[model samples]
Target: MAAATVLEVPGGPDGVREVRVSSPERLMWPADGITKLDLAEYFIAVADPFLRAVGGRPVTLQRFPEGIEGEEFYNKNPPKGLPEWARTVMCTYPSGRRHHQLVIDEVATAIWAAQMNTVTFHPWPVRAEQPDNPDELRIDLDPQPGRTFTDAVEAAYALREVLGELGLTAWPKTSGNRGVHVYARVSPTHEFLDVRHGVIGVARELERRLPDLVTTAWWKEERGERVFVDFNQACRDRTIASAYSPRPLAGAPVSTPVTWDELRDVDPRELTIRTVADLVRQRGDAWEGIDDPAHVGDVANAIALWDKDVHERGLGELNFPPDYPKMPGEPPRVQPSKRRKDREDGDYLAPKAERDAAWGLPVIPPVSPMLAKPVKAIPEGDYLYEPKWDGFRSIVFRSGDTVEIGSRNEKPMTRYFPEVVEAVRASLPEKCVVDGEIVVIGPTGDRLDFELLQQRIHPAASRVRKLSVETPAHFVAFDLLALGDDDLTERPFGERRALLEEALEGVEAPIHLTRATDDPAVAKEWFHQFEGAGLDGIIAKPRDLTYQPDRRVMLKVKHERTADCVVAGYRTHKSGDDAIGSVLLGLYTADGTLMSVGVIGAFPMARRRELFEELQPLVTTFDDHPWAWAEQEAGTRTPRSSEQSRWAAGKDLSFTPLRPERVVEVRYDHMEGVRFRHTAQFVRWRPDRDPESCTYEQLEEPVSFDLADVLGADR
Candidate 1:
């Protein structure tokens, strides 16, 4: 097949062997010895599809260590199996002993070959430093292309001032990658959430000071040109790519630490693995003595000193990353991830008056102007078929003169689209209740950003005011889910939709009429065309299908396929056994713990063989492993006894049983779950992912059963 990529090796294990790919196509998992720069390039190339899915967020790939320390982490588990050539790099030293130093050396070699010069050292985050003490504060900044490093440096200084005002000391370090990291030494008394809050406080202050150029939105899709103050990285187990390591891309790995002064003259793209080592050797490690003990609480107290009035500054109100679920009272940032703003003002309030005048008359429900009646037989063979929008599903209830609007969850969503409430109020004849969806042509026209519409969910009174001015959505009256004192939920969708349209008339803003068609050919064509328009997949409501909240009566088609995987073991070399080099996958059994399922040998060239040799000892005979199990029916092998089983009966084997505690979630296209249908790429470990929670349930059918049923069925 003339290998599909330039780096494909044939007839081998999943990631261990690579083959040539089409010019634009890169291999998924590669053999070990791939440098960080290469790894980065690989990710950049391969992950482009995933990147676009997240709206072009810049991503960085990080590698874990080969081992943690003296304990043989995954000798029997074989973190990930690598080819013999890659494993040879971890040759035994004169002492006849191997150490992680070899893995480090291998990574260093690959880094140089990849032409990467920068390396940021990111150790596991420990509880330390507050945001106040100037000495304890540290900042990591990565300057994007087209932006000046001074912008981040200036942001750091501004953040320091803000944190200092709150009562803390801040320390600054070059991330060795493209960014500079600012750390605030604070009392370790706070949990990750508290520290994040404190950090968010500092970030918000910076955003306020530089509103024209900065933002604290953690979701990449939501942030436009603003600098992102990423406090979410403060979560446990989160790590930034460190200095001098090789990446997965062909020539884009290798991060180098630098002095703040160097940032002024350096371009982030210049920091590749190939150049960082020489640069470090020539310049010596700057800030080498940066390990001095310092206090952390000094900075946190500084934030406490801020005036109550600053709360109005709205400094720390940005969104958090989706990976870490929000804490209570956290903004509803995950519901829909885009921010909306409107430029026109005069027309914003005009619709309310018109709807008010139509109050006594029937109000028009929001509908899919795109759909008409369904045809049992074929008409135009290539026509588009769409489901009729069942009018705006609005739920309104007023308290005195003030009216609060909400969606299915009873969340207060009137703020972002203040105009919707006014229209609703005008259309109602009495001090009554009503429910519908607000539909209008967005400023962008044609397509709708439902995510933008979702921004209306807010609890704060002031946030409501700002949102009203920033993004004013329109009202598209549809089904009256609740009308006056009656709950119409029990009614069929058609009946409710009918009552909705009959109830609202001349209520301004062209009322969208929800309609459906039975033309299968048109339906398929419409599905393809409207996908890019951001409409979630079409629903196959059997004209008879009623409204069922959170039910699968409606089928949805997403743009991609994603799944979660568990981290069963990591590969270590004969040398470096402290830092994990590469990872292995583990699938869960009915009993809960994960068994090593598959391996990903594609690593940056520098860490390849070291990772292989370091992990080789973790291997054991397939027959005797504790976690290893053979599916008697399928003839497939899996892990048994989640604990590391060093001896089978009385015979000593090379492998050891781990605590079976850690679980990770990975995104891949294919899955056997019993083992990866193919090698799985490494994603972040799930500190958020629980090992006991990793069950065989994700493999169940989405259309047929409830999640509870799936889990219970497994039981």
Candidate 2:
């Protein structure tokens, strides 16, 4: 290989930038036998178009000094002797530290970058003048495992449609490897947060439309074989390889921006430095009008799409990159598998059940009652107060290694909650049936996400297993239903409570049996505290009362929590075919994504007649209704079905997906996982409140009292 060579390249309007290349004979593209000098010439040829996309933007170069086959390093700051006119912008990093990053302002800068052995050009989407507000929205379509470039191409088209809906045009490009890059020019008025939100709104919309093929999950484990919409690239200080930059792969492929018309058949790998300028010369620049000042459109239109997503639909801000400050309402940042640390003290990680211990708690299901007046139940003598877990009332049966989770209606639910089954097996005795509420907790264990727990009920075993691994349901055992062969149901509540304590000796989380006391003062504090933390009121079980199956014997002291929910649709009353049976309730997630929380139906005859009269005018046909995908998204993380008919296997599920217009305030005691534990009570129609204000965040209650202290079973 020759040591060095001097090359004079035409520099667009800048006249010329005489660049000296070292080791000009060193093969950068061994496959095509293209050398270092060939790269310098390619950069000069594509300088105009490449500068149009990345010039004036702070850039980081992926430098391969020796060649693509040699060692590489990222060049963030410009070299010591940058050209006189070359600029740099101070950019902040994850450490809150800032550095002056290089800005390729002209064609000469492009050649200089090439001379540094930069195989790729990573440019910020924002110009140097306003680095905080990006004028362009970029989406990186990264193909993950089982996904290919074809998948990314398909995603780009879908993204195009989404962008068009927001009155924006997306320019498609190949990432010069396996991925695709799509960018839309936006007005620079809004800050980085606004642009990032717009990108998330588009990504989430795409994820919804093409869930099987697209993913916006920042967590790597959650993103399966799908095209990841890398919205984080829109964030401030983030950058991507600019058009015409060569990739560091075996083939020196360029990150070539293509016209939308040619996106279908274009192969990314073939667009190398050798061929990029030729294609550009033939088609002119695919981005000729890209950087024109007149072409810059108001980014507000796209921001409005985000507003419509979060403010109206309730899909709030999506997760930010971990290096960012803890964003408001962002889900916990911890990895799903590493969450064991949050609840590790107990038997959560036990390898297997202790079969030699006493097994099978033989007890009948306990009955519960509505005590909208818990204050009245405290003085009723020998009553224990426990927070009503906002989860499904279940009786978990465990024998040896086998565990069965029974729903309140006596249906088999073990399949839907495998982790809970494993938890039951690990914590409880060999043979025991413990009464509990199956709840889903967040990564930090600070809050209960009833909606997340509901996602466990997928028909497919694979999906259920997937969810089990992702969002495992927890069992909050409040009552000891049975103990070994010794039947505890027939025993008094106080005696059964004692046996329950003994049976759950080494039991831990997912099997936490909250200790009860006869003190009325502590009961009052717990009732209010638990309810504040989003838990359903307090449980007050009389000591002398026996377990009563299918009877409301145990007293539940819960304040009737009320929220104004949008009546997205109504189901006919099962009893009388004459009137509307129930109103389907929906709440907005943080990003303004509308989701069905539950339904309310038990209306008086007069109220039912009045509601039917009121709903008739607003009722809409289910065809293409926005809420048509209601049950699919509302019920589980895994798509059970495209419609409601698939929710319950044999239930007569039918309802019209209506326009979301009317809002109603309903009173309900608990949210069992996703949907309301029971039907919500209609308080009255809200004439003043907008349906959008009925956000689910209003229902979140802060977590209190460590489980270890609650159970007195701390490890």
Candidate 3:
């Protein structure tokens, strides 16, 4: 029997409860026959390359939970007494001095039933490689601790200044406690070492500028009489809870967001998920559409927005963390007598783990065996061949009349495809489970546009229904994993296909049987045919393979290329010596429009300097173009080339705003929607070519990367 639990809904029962999960395992792969190694490889494939590009230091991957059922989570323990075998403790906050116990069995039960792979569990600490404590730097001023919010606002400004010099953009997030979590996004070009060093540099600079008021020390013993800049928080694996993540400690788990002005008066505790909606309606989310890095460039601009001189010139104060680590040359910190009894008098860690464990948490053993096997190409004629449609790969489970859809990441995908429900109800066989590709198709032909497919994945149900009317979906099912309560994962591919065909014989609309071929050459040819037809690509599968859940038995082939782009301009610099200002990017638009695609300056100093001089005069600030070449005539907010690089200022301030000029031929691997998904490289410049010729029409209509289909029905 599970222990009883208490649940508090944020903003009342009307509030949203953000779910936070920590998953060290690679559970993001497809559920059908994927090995643990394959999953690890998936992450390594994505993350390791980014790590290597940033100087090859090890950085732990911290992924938050997405799209989980609300009922599947709980906060308070059951009203009934906890299980006798359970170990429980009441957790408390350092400031509020409040407490709560474990014994939350209902939340645990939901998690177990849902098979949620990710949770907000802290990874095992990295001992030696951890970041420096806040106590390491000298102390600063600002007597206002928990006073009017203005004190915090001033502190934020001061901290931003310190971060700016380090070439880091401090993105401010209200902690929903007290204080803020300032995030700085760096190019994946730096590993843990660079991140830690960069964090320290920022902290040290803050300490240097405000030694009397701000302390960069971590040890509480040494952080007396000064506000501490908690530097240890910068450890590579340490992740500040992202927006939408639930915090059990809060009265109601609230995710935090803020406006620059509100920072001065807003109390962190006041921003629970419940209160957030109303605030959002009133002020609007400042961070809306902020996920795309290309749109915002980097955090460098955010740092530049901070007003620093106002903070240094005025009377402001900062309150240091209670348990701040000791710093150099400072006497050990001693807590004020009034606060001694309030500290360390309650339980916190125990209840969090216990409440989570009491509900029979689903334990997933790492799939080391799957990793041991090398990924191989689908053997000749042993598998099925189908064009990999450009859409999300979903595994549909139908138990009786209940149907659920899941993404490759094991997340609830049903919300994004409500229209698929109608098709399943009309066509799917009774008590059956099937695997297939869900693609959005146009009115004319077999060619599927990924942009159209992506449009169907909206969060709103009404919008999805509308889109379904405009562009209906096609379920190209290739495998039958279960029928009439029998798990057929162990069945061979040939048998599964036979079973699938029998099951879907009378399916009504939208759901169609996927075409498969035995010949490898035919399969290869189909790849091009499908591609030319505007479909993604094709997958070749071995016919005799069994359905192994979570194992990679398929291969993906994508049609991709790379292209070189000339450096345009850069944003402001961060705090480090090798810090980059901004790398302005350019590409020719259709009808000879020289549109600015975005910024890209994640390069070493030498590269940055060389590019800056070459492109300086091109900076023109016409009313028609706010960003490009702005400030040629002075009296502009845009920084001058001299400020960008000493060698480039005054060297022909007037740049030839050439008529959509400068041509460079380059290759790109993949195109997402209308833009290159990754950074376009610098290929050789085409000086002899006319710039007008480099129109947006020259950009490819994005090739298809049908990865899902490539990993066919082999595992």
Candidate 4:
């Protein structure tokens, strides 16, 4: 069925425009093939700097019926059979609901959204007739999990010197993936909650002058590995990813728009969707007159540095986006074991001046954040599970030879792992403390590769002693918390795993000993064999409870299940596509083909936009979707793609195809073949199931287990 093609695009100031473009060499980027007529000749070769950075605003599109691995969605109206020069508006939402949306304004509304499969473009920082005042104050920057992408390009050059001391003029870009957005042209005379508290007073003055490389947390479990800043993307129906849009990842990248001297040899995955219309015709619109306002002052000078960090330096207001609404001094959205079962069961003390203000030269308090709680089955008795390590929890103190290593906000990361503070000061007992993690490994060992354990959090101490001797980090330990000269935080947990196995006996070579067991069928078969060594799962506890530091009588469990998938493609729904942000699920393959098995986004947000308006009329975008995306091509590659290696090796995938006629089911718990090694959970929408009886043989084989007798093997 792949035959419908029609073209003659480029018609804006009104010229040619014939556009039917149905399957014009379809592909969309079957890994570097780029078609739908090369994403409509890249918006007709950067239609005037992509309509001067999303023309009259209100936009939202991001669709991808079946390219860039297919199945993407988000239209914000004007989609059904839209054409008369595409436009719409109404909007509103923060759940105060309202609708309509779409506005783009030119290149025939991005070639009528490249003939309905829009690839990327999410405008709206207000404009579409003052949608609540905002003239773009954006920021984004993101990069959490022990951060990287050169730590959001050094927190975007320290947020471009705090938006040049609050006069404003940023503009950066490349959030095609791996963070970095920036923006800045404000003055719509305030509101969108005052440009989100002037981006939370320039992200708390760049987290008080890069305090250990910036963070504005807003949850991801208190963003520990830095570079966050996101300041509710100026709230009022928050939107971003627009400057020349196109980021459904896998090298169809292009959240382009750079400069500040093309960021040290820029390469935002070479801004694509086919070279961002020759990178905006060889760099001309570095946000040309991006709303040109010229302001060396007023965003009320970053809301007077967030009103001097909320009335004189106790810096408040953060943690939003849990689908907004509840804000205003937000601090207690529970967790910390339900805020320590509403406090009062003693033994917490610690706040030594907030652990000497989390180490901006204060010292002494060495341990706190021990939290945990993220359950879901596997807790029917006794406990003591252990194993979890995906890197960096630390604690580790020592006394008579003074060792340190803290973190979880007690900071002093003993100068970034000096061989894990000289192997916990030559294996404990001259006064100790333990609780561990730290990791890195991977030279075949593989426990933590939080991107090579964030290259030992560098600020160059000889690049953290040359990445602690070329990739060497190790810790492990696992809860002992003060051993010699007691203080085992009110004991129990089978006596801190028997004094963390007698303080790691001869803990030499970067310290290790962290196993545990009270058998829950060997902790559910070492929680699916510690995801082949890069762990992050089993931590049950309760062997008579106690050690409650940052509370949450431990729990964790991990690996969940459910799988039927096949929905394919979804994104854009934080108040736009009416709801989605995840779907891409495909499966089939007993050679007949269909593959891609990962994507479900924990749905249940009141059945997420009514399950994309119940799969938006079973959207198919090609032979043509051939029984639900098969006759190869939405980023082709298979004979079961050489038996999937937990993906990502020249990956570049996308999703969105359904006409095999509905089938969903979801629940998952590590699969590996057609993907889903995590996130599956939806569990419904079957329409009497049968997307080819959802194949890959109903997936269940993940039993063989081993963690070498649960970590007792230094083998």
Q: Top model by TM-score, which number?
A: 2
Looking at candidate 4, what is the lDDT of residue 624? Answer: 50
Candidate order by TM-score, decreasing, is 2, 3, 1, 4
Decide which is better by lDDT, 2 or 3.
2
Give lDDT tens digits, candidate 1, residues 643-706. 2433234432223334455565565423332554445565555667776667667753222112
TM-score quality measure for candidate 1: 0.32
TM-score against truth, every candidate: 0.32, 0.47, 0.39, 0.25
Please write out the lDDT profile of model 4 over residues 1-715, one tens digit for every residue.
2565666766545676776777777677777777777777778777888888778788778788777675687766456556756666656555443445678777766876876778887888877888777776888888887676678887788888888877787878878888888887776788787678888888877888888888786666766788888888778766887877677667688888888788756878877776667656765778777665564235888888888878887877765565555556666554453467646523444323333333222113444655777878667588777777767787766766777787776677788778777766666666766777787765555334566776578766988998888997878777775666565666677887776776576565567787777778877767777776657578888878766455454778777656675665565455456777677677877876776666677654456778778777877675556433353444564322333333345443344455656677887656543466556777678877767778878776654434334455541
Give residue 335's error in model 3 in angstroms. 31
Cα lDDT of candidate 1 equals 0.43
Write the number of the candidate with greater TM-score, choosing between 2 and 4: 2
Q: What lDDT would each prediction earn against the true structure?
A: 0.43, 0.73, 0.46, 0.69
lDDT of 3 by residue, 1-715 (tens): 1222232212213442322222323222223332222222222222211111111111122222222222223322111222333222222222211112222222222222112332222211121132212111111222234333344456667886765555554556555444455544444443332344445455556666667666655555556556566654543334344443334342433335555666666676666434555565676555553334632233332222222322453321222233322222223234344345444523222232233223221211110110012223434645676665566666776654666675665565676676787678678865666777787654445455566777776756788778877887767677776677565656687888888878877654467777677777877776665564455556655667655444445555555554444434445454332334555445655543344543344554556566556655555544445334454454433323323433245433222232233456555434544455445555566787665554455555634434234332332
- Candidate 3 vs. true structure, TM-score: 0.39
Which segments of candidate 1 are over 4 A away from where they belong? 1-123, 127-150, 160-178, 185-187, 219-222, 243-253, 294-299, 302-318, 334-715
What C-alpha root-mean-square deviation, in Å, does candidate 1 show against the real structure?
A: 25.9
Model 4 segments more than 4 A misplaced: 1-35, 38-40, 47-118, 121-195, 198-232, 235-238, 241-287, 291-711
